[model samples]
Target chain A: MVSIQNLHKKFGKHTVLDGLELNIDDHGIIAVLGPNGSGKTTLIKSILGMVVPEKGSIHINGKPLKNNWEYRKEIDYLPQIANFPGNLTVIELLKMIKDLRGEAKREQELINFFGVNKFIDKKLTNLSGGMKQKVNLVLTFMFDSPLVILDEPTTGLDPVSILKLKELLHKEKASGKTILVTSHIMEFVESVSDRIVFLWEGKIYFNGSVEELKEKTNQRDFEHAIATLLTGEHV
Target chain B: MFKILKYSFFDLTRSSWSYIYFLFYLLLGIVLLFLNNDLSNAVITLMNVIIILVPLIGTIFGVMYFYNSREFTELLLAQPVKRTSIFLGQYLGVAVSLSLSLVLGLGIPFIAYGLFQSPAIWDFTMLLITGVFLTLIFSALAFNIALSSENKIKGFGYAILMWLLLAVVYDGVFLLSLVYFQEYPLDKFSLIATMLNPIDLSRILILLKLDISALLGYTGAVFKQFFGTSFGSVISLSVLVLWTILPLLNIARIVKKKDF
Candidate 1:
């Protein structure tokens, strides 16, 4: 479970997250949807303690996240970009992360599932965009963290891989893990996420199930409901 | 911190640049010792090179390492690791490896050249000490520059500019100021100025230790008069240590509030 209150963040003159508050205790997938620069990534990074909030406190499982790192042990983060040290081979990178985090509950299994074994010996820089993402995915899911945060997780995946990811995410959710995701693919979000939390201008615009969002916006289709939220249409 | 340091050290050791750096010093030491044919003479020549070159390498290497390891840093930032540990570990990893290259590179030739039996051993040891100190100081400063700069070009630019200012420009300005204010008492001014730049302090320290202050002109005489041989070396070395510690502390402070 993650709790945030009064989160305020700014980049120079622009305010990215302002007086934002969120509480996610649900045990299923929660999609954080927002237009570009709407603080979706900022909100996620805040909870991970990667971005220090100017004002507000975040708690993970009842412990304040300020100046704390141990709480991250229970969290697995897939960064927006899959940039890594190019010199390291894929296997070395995985082993390095595993070594740093002390243990990997299911690394070998995840590696097999993601099919990263094909280019396991190659350097990270040499891998293609989609393959690098596969490596990134393996690194995140290898550790059985209670909280899974995926930022743009579907960046370079093929359709088949994405289907596999959906299956993996559902399995994770079924095991009582809290998964937070952010992606531009509405259909993917709609299919996988149990609850959708829409953000607009640094504030939570809507936090409800898919049916609730559709009924509130008076849109028959899920995509139209989301478009209405963006178009500033009916609530 | 130690684990991060270990990985970084391994990472650098595998890099070809580290080996090239090692070999450059190795070649320099071998050529200098053999050609000079005298321990004391080689020590003095090595002093000149170490004072200037060490800081230059430290700065470039530090900045390059910080920028290059950015992905590694981002990955670590999201994990169960403290911010300070990630940075300090990388900084130390660079400093230690560079120092190793310097010590082993120069030490091999000197030791092979019958250095221990020679009277110039102390001077050689002093040269290595200052070289290591310079490496630690400038790399820490470079890490600070890279940390504060989000753009790699800007970080690299600032790092090189810092080295140029300290290594070459600082002495020129110090002398110009001394000549411009010749009528006034400039002893305190010169001493304070020398202490501010690690390169200058190192130059003065080695010159004083070598008992060659006469060759150094006004500022060296001022340093020699103010702190004598033993005291002057101690004070200069302490300042070098201070230079290293301050930047490292600044890094820790910066990381506390910085966004990844």
Candidate 2:
């Protein structure tokens, strides 16, 4: 579980997160929906302690997140970008991360599931964009952490790979893991997210089930509902 | 910390740039030794190269490494490791690897030249000590610059400008001030100015240890006139150590507050 309160963050004159609050106590897929610069990544980064909030307190499972890292042991993060150390081979990177965060024997399973074994020995820079994303997914899904934070996990993924990812997310959810996802694909968001937390202007605009969102917006289609939300038409 | 250090060290070692840097130093050392007949003069020449070149290399490598390893850094940042350890480990990785390349590159030729057997061993050791100190100091400064500036171009620009200021422009300004204030006794001014910059401190330290007063230009001459050899060496070494520590501490402080 995660809890956030009164978060305030500003970039120069632009305010990204202001007086925002969020809490998640469910073990299921949650999609963080927002327009550009809506503080979606900022929120995730703050929870991970990668970003320092100007004024806020984040608590992970009852403990303060400030100056605390032990909680991260239960959280696995998949960054938005698939950038990696180009000089490192996929295997070396996988091995290095495994070494850093205790041993994970399921790496091979994830590697094969993602079909990354073909180029596992190649340098990361040599891999294609989709391939790199696959590697990123493998790294994230390899560990069986209780919580996973994935930023734009659908980037550069093909239709087949996307289905595979969906299956993996389902597998994790079935096992009672709390997964956080952010993506622009309406179809993907509609198919996978159990709950949608819509962000507008650094504040949560909507937090409820898919049916609840459609009912609030008075829109028949899911995509049209999100469009209505972004247009500031629905409260 | 050690895990990060090991990966960073391993990553850097595989890069061809490291080998090129090592080979460049090795070539410089061998050429200097063979060309300069007098061993003491060779040591002094090595001092000059180490003074200007070490810091430049350190600054460039430090900035490059930080910006290059950004993805690697973000990956580590998300882990359960302490933030301080991440930066410190990477810092040590760069500094230690660079120092190793320096020691081995220069060491091979010098030791091959029987430098240990000659009476200039102390002078050579002083040169290497100052070399390592300069590397540690400038690299920390570079990491500090990179950590502060989010834009890579801006980070690189500031880092290189810093090297230019301390290594090249500072000397010109120091000389101009000495000339402008010729009527005044510049002993204290010159000593303090030299001590303030690690580049100047290192050069004077080696020159004083080598006892080559003639090569000790205006500022060095002023330093020699003011402090005894042992006294000046101790002070300069301590200041260099402080130089290394202060920037590193700044790095820790900045990272504690900085957003990814």
Tens digits of per-residue lDDT for model 2 on B193-258? Answer: 988899999998898899887888887777776677888788888999999999999999998998
Query: Per-residue CA lDDT of candidate 1, range A1-235, in tens?
Result: 7889999999999999989999998899999998899999999999999999999999889999987999999999999999998999999998888888978979889889999999999999999999999999999998999999999999999999999999999999999999999999999999999999999999999999999999999998999999999998793
lDDT of 1 by residue, B1-260 (tens): 99899999999999999999999989988999898888888888888889889999999999999998999999999989989999999999999999999999999988999988998888888889899999999999999999999999999999999999998998899889988999999999988888888898888878877898556678788888888878988898889889989999999999999997
Judge candidate 2 at residue B21 and give its lDDT.
Answer: 86
Question: What's the true lDDT of residue B121 in model 2?
Answer: 89
Candidate 1 local lDDT, residue A169:
98
**What TM-score does model 2 score on chain A?**
0.98
Q: Give the true-structure RMSD of model 1.
A: 1.1
Return the clash pairs for model 1, or none: none
- Candidate 2 regions exceeding 4 Å error are none
User: After aligning candidate 2 to the native by TM-score, how far in Å is the CA of B48 from where it should be?
Assistant: 1.4
Report the lDDT tens digits of candidate 2 across residue range A131-189.
99999998887879999999999999999999999999999999999999999999999
| RMSD each, Å | 1.1, 1.4
Q: Candidate 1 chain B, which ten residues in sequence have the lowest lDDT sum? A: B212-221
